[model samples]
Target: MTATAVAASVPVARGYRFELVKLWSQRRVRLLLLTCWAGPALFVAAVSQQSTLPVDTLFGRWMHATGWAGPLVTLGFAGTWALPLLTSVVAGDVFAAEDRLGTWRHLLLAVRSPRRIFAAKVLASLTVIMLLVAGLAAGSTAGGLLTVGNHPLVGLDGHPLAPADAAGTVLLAWICVLAPTLALAAIGLLGSVALGRSPMGLLLPVLVALGLQLAQMMPLPVPVRVALPGYAFIAWNGLFTSPAQLGPLLIGITVSLVWAVTAAGLAYRIFLRRDFTDQAYDGAGRRALTSGLLPLAGVLVVTIAVIVPVTGGPSSGIEQDKVQRSVATAFAHLYRLQTEQLHRPAVTEVQLDTSAACTRGGGRLEPQGPGNDWRCVVSWHLPGVPAAGSATYQLDLTPDGRFMADGDGPKEVNGYFLVRTPAGDAPNPLWQFDGTVALLPTVPKG
Candidate 1:
């Protein structure tokens, strides 16, 4: 029989819809789907019932653990492992499943061309992937809203965001996060096609993902990090805070697409040419990558090489502003605490020991309270001079409202205190209180 005659005898595929049905009817595919939906609901339910999740954080608590709880939790749930695995279920099986079952020849014979057969398989795999992802998004979003409501979103970056805007960002963020897995799916499908092993298509991409994840976490060059498919999953970091991070997410999606296409193209070429008859169904695999994907791999390599030098910071001395602010805030808390704590209160008591005060701590600090009320405390111990021999002294005030220092150690010592004026009034400090020489109201050291 002539090659042309053999090819001509095969039937053309009517549409992807027919292939979709054939793919969907598989028991494994149905089970994969059922598990995906059930797992999320069970997770949300268990968490909601047991969680002490800050329900009162000004964002109305989840109305139902299932509805509003899912989307909110999905970042942690699916972004890590579920999405990638979910994708692999179909991708690893798409083309390879036929080969594993010894049905590849039958499929090619029916479709008339390897290209059409590959298309139908890819189409089916992608359809399943898209639906599964959509299902996750829909179920989780609805769960989160039902349980948590459409209140303002508190983002990963510690900023509060309105739900209307946050919803868009969250959706974008999740989709972008999906890019890495989507890319893996493409690669896995290729593995399915090339290896004729259902598990290899699923497992190999995951191992690669793990390897990339490890590499991603290391202190690699910025360009290297940017090129990783695993980079998109890191976007979950942005879920808690925003001005939604679009920059890294966008770059990650590009990297994912490149890897995905490269894998898919190679799979396509191998499937079209490689003879299956009498070929070992185990151990051996496609030996070469296709010509079409070479450019993509080259571009990735070139981009990483070029970008590393320009963005890597110059080796030099520097001061970070973030550290400075943190130090200042610490100073503020300490200053307030000491000032309030150190100052001794007099309840018509006898003579009390007093200490000298320093105006400020080491850091550059501005006085916070009203005019000249910028009082500070220091641990002071007056030395060298002996006690004033327990001299009993009387205190008196002058007409100009100055408490005369007629007592032993000069009557009144003036110090700063915070005093506020009436509303719409200028800032002022009233009656500078004396830290020393307490005017005891006829009370003694009894």
Candidate 2:
């Protein structure tokens, strides 16, 4: 067929199929899928045989107790860098590979329109990304179940979830991560089109993710932090709580959509306008980098300017009221478990009438906001005891509203580091616990 006839006959779907075939034929893409599927299983098996648990990660402490914990723990760890790096490997290289091979001119001639080619590449990249995530989630869950057995899961709110319910929640948590992962992929796509170099394209999105992570650690305004794509990675924490906090999840979805649309739209515009002539490719590196970076920098500056003026408060989204409530609720639920372990009478959260008074820096600073020095004095009523029982806890909080709290309490109840149970000594459910407060403002119950 003639070049003109071929270009005229080719549809977006045909181009999309060509891109998909190209991706599937690459060894790196196949290797990525294999690693995603097998890596978690191996890690879970290794960890199961170890003497120590990954207590630092959310749900890590419960890995041995429940199969569902493995995927959630893996999810937490992956959010840090794995997700971004995995997506970037494909999205970042898809377009740049054409540049490297000097095939863009031929591909464009065949496809006729850069717009159609861009759409095809994007669709193919996104499809592969989704598959990668699904493989990760499935592999983690399968590994956990095989190694640990399907036991009851201790949730973030200190409630026990049935195996079936825990499985559903774990899957849902993975689903929630898709929005931000896709946004990062879109950013990677932008880098690929802009830099027209595989190395820079692959690393740019990962670097951006790292920068956003560091920014989240800073005391940026609550709105500003929530608006960042990085925040959506940890937004799944809310799903593990009882009466799950949907505020952060909702905000994360919205923010991720905005980022994906903005970055992808910019990439589309740039791709459509680029010259693919053999001569134009000779001295295009400097021009391409300048054109790509300048618009992105401008967009970021305008976004920050708009966001900062509207939400300038220094509050870290880790508000005192929300933290106190989250801690108190988790404490009540765990205390009941402790009581059950002791063969004591059953108790409910409401009957405990739990309340916590929290402060930071020994009251030198306000109780609200994120800090390492947060301390809370929790008081609750026991059924037969005349005096109210109290325990002190030291909390280290992150800007995204997740905190690790260590109880300073009576050794008999809290038990040094491990709590005594019928199954010998196990990690204390209350001695140290992790919990997340809804970052968005919530309505007080009447």
Best by TM-score: 2
Residues 1-446, candidate 2: write the lDDT tens digits.
21122336468899899999999999989999898899988888678667889989998888877778889888987888789898789898888888888897688668877778888999999989888888889888888999999998988888889999998899888988888898888889888887775487878789989988898788777767776777779888888888888777877776777778878887887777677764235323676556666755665565555555434444566777888898898898898888887667898888899888898999899777788999988899998889998888989988778899888886765536777777687667788888887766676554
In order, the Cα lDDT scores of the candidates are: 0.50, 0.81
Error of 1 at 383 (Å): 39
* Model 2: residues with Cα > 4 Å off, grouped in runs: 1-7, 279-314
Q: How many residue pairs clash in each candidate?
A: 24, 0
Query: In candidate 1, what residue range of length 10 has the lowest lDDT sum?
Result: 433-442
In model 2, what are the clashing residue pairs, if there are any?
none
C-alpha lDDT (0 to 100) for residue 261 of candidate 2: 82
lDDT of 2 at 211: 89
- The stretch of ten residues in a row with the least summed lDDT in candidate 2 is 1-10
